[model samples]
Target: MTLRIATAGKGGVGKTTFTAMMTRALVEKGARPALVVDADPNANLNYYLGVKYDATVSDLRESLKRDQPPSGMSKPDFTALKISEILSENDGYDLLAMGRPEGPGCYCFVNEVLRAAMTRLASKYAVLLVDNEAGLEHLSRRTTDDVDNLFIVSDSSIVALRAAARIKLLSASLELKVKNISLVLNRIKSDAEREAAISSARDIVGKDTQIAAVIPEIAEIGGMLSSGSNVFLLKDFPREILEPLVSPHET
Candidate 1:
């Protein structure tokens, strides 16, 4: 069984950065052939992972309306083949971008086909890491339904904590089959700010949700990102901060 992990938060909350770092850490720890899905419409995880993708799932969905499979090929098989073609294979993982959001139309057939294809593809990997948008659109669509760990990231701010809290509430309403949910406070500058964020998060996300990690504001990481360097190149990245989130059995 594949270990499914997902990161969710509002825009500019560093969820994407966290996802990238976690991917590098997983790869370093011998978690090979992981499938990293960039579910964000903005789709910049490729840059963070130092990989490039030609097409996105959205492009394929759009093409399905106009393109047909070969005379003897089934639509599902063709869709799966296209998905494979778009995958950006890297040293230890494959990247799949969700691309832009769906346009004005009913995508029932296209969505079902993509979902089935994703499931088939994910089974070949040991882990599946998804970088989700603020709205949790992919989860709502049931594209990646059974998540093992859902990390809600938030910066050290009241507003960000509130947004994280709302995400926790939304996840409950969606009834996602998530085994564990944790709050990852990112870019915390001081202990006071961390305490405040934790307090706010507890009130907003409830006491049941644990505060899994609080990553400090590391200037090296910022510099590396600004230089368009991949997360793997960062020196002394606080990967131990993510250890609590990954189960021992899964690793």
Candidate 2:
């Protein structure tokens, strides 16, 4: 099964971490190769994945906007070259970084082409995980709609629920082709906290969607920030949570 998962939510809510961890786990579970599109402008996924790319989608878009690469290359040729250069392969998955523009206003054409190319590329992999910007590019509608599973990651804060509700509405307005709009409540400390987090998410989803997983707050994860050692081996947490979210479809 080809599952495209889009992880989106407020900034600092562990969206990137969730995306990276889930992708890694899927790889270990004997799934076919997976692809990750780090569409967030911050582009921190690269640092976490420990892969250095030569160019980004933004770099390519800038090349098109600027009308030439630094070496005066054509857009199509530059596109093929940059697409290969920016895709980093490691740990049985490849990461494509959608970088922040070095300078720009909008990336209309490049974004369309990149999305199209990705849609075609999606058929080749077992999964495509997208880590998107936080309402920055208005990309949620397009990115999340095509996914097989779209998780709205949130913290345990009250603000998180409210923001999530808004994001859900925004997603609806964008008319995204969401297969399953699931919520992932992250960073809970205690059982009580976990319950509260799940409850909060339930309220936000409000009779339509459901909480897929509640990830416990792990101190070690914070410590691994600079190392890029994702939660592939997060035995207690990742598997505990993700197995349920995806288990039914596994068989």
Residue 160 local lDDT, model 1: 76
Q: How many Å off is the CA of 177 in candidate 2?
A: 0.9
What value does the lDDT take at residue 48 in candidate 2? 60
Worst 10 residues of 2 by lDDT: 135-144
Per-model TM-score, in order, reads 0.89, 0.84
Candidate 2 per-residue C-alpha lDDT over 87-122 given as tens digits, one digit per residue, 9 for 90 to 100: 788777888887664447665654665575467766
TM-score of the candidate numbered 2? Answer: 0.84
Kindly report which residue stretches of model 1 are placed more than 4 angstroms away from their true locations once superposed: 70-72, 104-114, 248-251
lDDT of 1 by residue, 47-135 (tens): 88777899888887768768999899987778878888888999899998877655654546545644664477788988888888776
Every candidate's lDDT:
0.79, 0.71
